[model samples]
Target: MWVLVLFDLPTETRKDRQVATRFRKSLLDDGFSMFQFSIYMRFCASRENADVHARRVKKSLPKHGKVCIMQITDKQFGMIELFHGQKEIEPEKPSQQLELF
Candidate 1:
């Protein structure tokens, strides 16, 4: 499972910039990695784990911005095609999580 957080926050004023920065920091602190300027993604071992992160993202949303939370299966994510200046690039592979009994 993958939890993708996409947001566009206001950064016109100092306070707005601070709030936006805090939001990004919170996402990083919660284990999400930057996928793009306004996109962050985290891999989870299960749907339940993804839900937890999605809830956390909701809890930290800024008061004056647009935010979206999306969940995709590993297969779906793997099908994504990336490019850099017309050259094809491979999509990122999710890190394997160690499980302990």
Candidate 2:
């Protein structure tokens, strides 16, 4: 299984930099590879391991920060591919449909 973790921190002041640094370091200690800056991570492990690591990462973050974890399996990746292949809808569709009423 692959787990992707996304997080954001409130940047009210310079303090956010320190907190973000600590959070990243904690994730690293927990054996998570950095895929992006507080955006994505890849962890190859079992579901239980992923959950435990995600919780630890969340706990290590600052009080004002936000974190989200998503576990992806092979089937989920296939679904993503299907969704990505869909065409985009025109922006005017909603208004045009409403006017028909």
Candidate 3:
């Protein structure tokens, strides 16, 4: 499973910028990778695990902006296509090594 987090936090003032930076740091501390400036992604072992992370993200949301979360299966995540300009870039692939529970 994958937990995708997308957020847009205000940065109109110094305090707002600080708040946004703190929020981004918190996401990294919680094991999310920066898929984009406001988009973060993390891999979870199962649906329940994804829910746990989603709730964690929910609790960390900022007061003045929007936050969204999505949960996708490995197969669904694999089907995502990325593009830079007019070229279609290769999407991220799942790791091949088996994981021991």
Best by TM-score: 1
lDDT: the better of candidates 1 and 2: 1
Per-residue alpha-carbon lDDT of model 1 for 1-101, expressed as tens digits? 98999898999999999999999999999999999999999999999999999999999999999999999998899889899989999887778788686
Q: What are the RMSDs of all candidates, in order?
A: 1.0, 14.9, 2.1
Q: Once superposed on the true structure, which residue ranges of model 2 sit more than 4 Å away at CA?
A: 74-101
Ranking by TM-score: 1, 3, 2
Q: Of the candidates shown, which would achieve the greatest lDDT relative to the real structure?
A: 1
The better-scoring model by TM-score among 1 and 3 is 1
lDDT of 1: 0.94
TM-score of each: 0.95, 0.62, 0.88
Stretches of candidate 1 off by over 4 Å are: none
Alpha-carbon lDDT of model 3:
0.87
How would you encode candidate 2's per-residue C-alpha lDDT over 1-101 as one tens digit per residue? 55777888876677877777777788777766665677555545467766776777667767876788888764553344212248643321111112122
Instruction: Mark the 10 consecutive residues where model 3 has the least summed lDDT.
Output: 91-100
lDDT, candidate 2, equals 0.64
